[model samples]
Target: MPTAHAPGTTPITGVTIDAVLAGRLVRPLFQPIVDLSTRTVVGVEALARGPAGSALEFPDRLFAAAGAAGRLGELDMLCFERALEGAMAAPVAPPLLFANGEPAVMDQPLSPRLMELFASRPSFRAILEYTERALPSVPGSLLRLAGQIQLGGNGVALDDVGVDPMSLAFLPVLEPEVIKLDMSLLRDPHATHSRTVCAVVRGEARRTGALVIAEGIETEDDLVTAREMGAQWGQGWLFGRPGPLDGAGHRYDRAAAAAVRASRPGFHQPDGTPFEVASARAPRLPGTAEGIAAALDRVRHIAASDDAAVVVASTDDLPVSLYELAGQARSTIVLDRPVPGEFAVAVIGPGYGHAVCFRSTGGPELVMVDDLPTVAAVSRVLLNRHTRG
Candidate 1:
């Protein structure tokens, strides 16, 4: 793939990306995701390519151009539509279609053509796969979008797990129906990092019954390692490289596809203030400014760690510690106002959620919540406020 631009040259402009979109030049290829136990095709992941024989024929170059041109959302949606079109036209489509989604583009409304495709083929089910790379920056957005996708009877997947250590923490935040382990894990299953990933992934799978798929299986040994790591499905050159779907001779497994759809996490959009949301789930305890400060320190610790936490707090006065938290957190917002009766601080990170709220009518009595969903809800509420403001 060519660089976005040669050194000293101007950046790749939107004109190129715009032309590709206008011409519908994205080529969609399907790679089979197979059941390891039965060695049968359970689904296919759609891989996007650019126009044939073009400088952007490969995805890396294509997406780089899109990103440089500030048209990633448009390009992402186009690839999704093209993939759906290809699957729809295939003589024997796989039971399920896995589509890769960029977090920056995930919040965009579904394209009209895509919506039409969904309406036309009600039986067509998809599992939207999001990588962990950009998730920490926009987790609230993903949470909201994932809920919408699940509500529409689709499923969510976390792709390229184990590539980033922080991704392990986010397992609870995403609660993905399918977890795709990075190829490195299979290649080096005995490595300490790979072992940690396997343990966390196995625990998550057992807890939620999420299907695990291992990528990068080019050898029989890789397959054995994948199975040992608890992967139920496998994908890579071992099964088949990504290619036109019609030639794969894959038979649709309706039962397996239905199972994918049934895996939706049933997430709903959280409402109410942080305190109200958390207090509803857990009781409020009497506390002092000192206690609130201690809780904020805990939030600061998480923010400073590699957990990729987001911190939001409403306070009339900004403290040095709050500033430090903002400096360390993935994203932080300090609202300058009287703290709401419901909550003053909310921290949401991978596998963690916490909130501290002061009672509106009382003298410094507070509510501190540690419930995961409640913390997520509180974080959503705070983030929404920040977005809206």
Candidate 2:
């Protein structure tokens, strides 16, 4: 175990470029992020540790050293390669690998390296993680590379934009597949109402047409905050701490046991979110828009109600002439349509609403609701799923 260094302990005052990489450099460590409900480890951020004897072991210090050495691009690529390789070797293979990227790297040719890595591991689908802090001066070429990388079946993500103005601008342009929120921002206890920064992120994330992932979560409170803030996915210590790429415990930090001790083991917050719990097992893949409607139609038919007597609606369905849950009151039931056969007929609506429930099996299973705003909201929830794959 390494002890925390004192102030000015190991300064990278004048390390040359070659000096920085001459030793056992680039140590990769994992951090665990849990699904809000399941309390299971969803993914890990393969953080970079600098050279064995260098003063730049931590992320901030390592990046600083790279910057000073005029080798920021080199370091970024190093970390990306390490993260991809580490993730591939990990025991729990996460579908999403968040390798950090910088504007400088985007300024250069990135596709060849990306293509080469994936060519070696055909099954690995990774996300190039970008943060608000990293803005590309050359937006044109940057977006081109981003698009090219994604077209290869990989993804581009804006990591931890979290309501920042830079991220806000990044959203309309980058349009990344994944929009990650720094869990530290989402976990702010000051997020009291819908007007807080966290709330603002939730709203903006919806319009951007990207999946929201929370990062930096360290406790049950953080996970609760993530759900309350409308984050479909996030990572932190409570879910699963990062271990070795080969499935060993985290070398520097012991997150698994610490989380087990710190977490309250409860799902419901005062806000009533079913946090930190997973479906008893992997859920059936949610039905398609047509499939959902068909299921509802069957339910209403068996209920012996006219289409108006008992409404059949898609998961794409939403409040019409009635109220719907908003803010922390919304509950999304993510389902996978596995063992495809018949869906039990029942109107699934938010609690306390005068929503209809039709019960039946096998029939015209769905009815479509044609409203734009409702459609948008349904699309928001419907498109968001727990499928890491």
Candidate 3:
């Protein structure tokens, strides 16, 4: 008698998980997490794809095949090693690298592997994100291992929150440093259940001081809804699409990210005024006063001619001419001030003003227009709020 193939044991792809690990067929791609206020890249999540045109080319099937093949542990370790190697090899100083792992396998202490990865690059910060759909039967072991991970100077993030009841139970016990909101909840922020779950998660995050990142945002409305729901960080197509690390940090497109951040429909002014700016018109202006003046003049003349609802001005030094121009145009001015606002929304880059005073806020500030890409990317959002009373 030959032998019985395990049910669902048929390989989904021509390659086996063992072959993937041996051949190093798994490649790494990175998707960035944008700090909502700054619109700058804060972290990059490592995603695994198999060789081109392979059966495991996509992550879902790749992992599923591994599980069926009883090689989940091997595959997870390979992913961890590859992700760390790929991120470190990139030209830019690595941002926080988020590596995913299987919850069941992770029940064993990961300190050994983690310490090895960090041995050379001691300054590198790694956050192990758990993507398991269900809780381990003995969750205590996983919790203990999580504590060990922190002790080793690493952090843990619960990936895809609201996907299952088990994740809800893991929240406080695991005490994750970050909570990634599932994209499904964001697809319809108005859905009562989604709203309720968001509220619950937000409450937990506030209580725990864990940062919340809303993932899978596909539209501007999705971005707006994530912010309104109190997400401090966001990731999705609206920010930038995931791409291979390729050594040059190809995953991030600064100008493109800035444009999308600015064009989103609902930013607010200090007086609770709401306005809209066209992304096309919000060209990335130069950082200097002369550049600021010219961009302002151009926007002002055009807005006046079109009778547009908004004019955006972002400068390192608030020019009198720019203010005077706004006054002349009678358009509402959204100045990027150094002081805290009565109602200041979080924005990125140093030039955007208020955030500059706090160095700890970090990442890129809207300094020169280059930092954030364009005039529209800067101050327009600071002045636009939902229609107020």
Maximum-lDDT candidate: 1
Ranking by TM-score: 1, 3, 2
lDDT of 1 by residue, 82-145 (tens): 9989988988777788999987666678889888877786456788898986565666567766
Give the alpha carbon lDDT tens digit for every residue of 65-126 in model 2: 67877888777777777777677776556544567776655566654664587778644456
Candidate 3 residue lDDT tens string, 51-78: 6566677787788988998878777778
Q: Model 3 — TM-score against the truth?
A: 0.58
Error of 2 at 247 (Å): 2.9
Tell me the lDDT of model 3 at 329. 29
- Please rank every candidate by lDDT, starting with the best: 1, 3, 2
Winner of 2 and 3 under lDDT: 3
Error of 1 at 271 (Å): 2.6
What stretches of model 2 exceed 4 Å from their correct place? 1-17, 22-24, 111-114, 187-200, 204-209, 248-389
User: Cα lDDT of all candidates, in order?
Assistant: 0.75, 0.47, 0.55
Candidate 3, lDDT over the whole model: 0.55
The model with the greatest TM-score is: 1
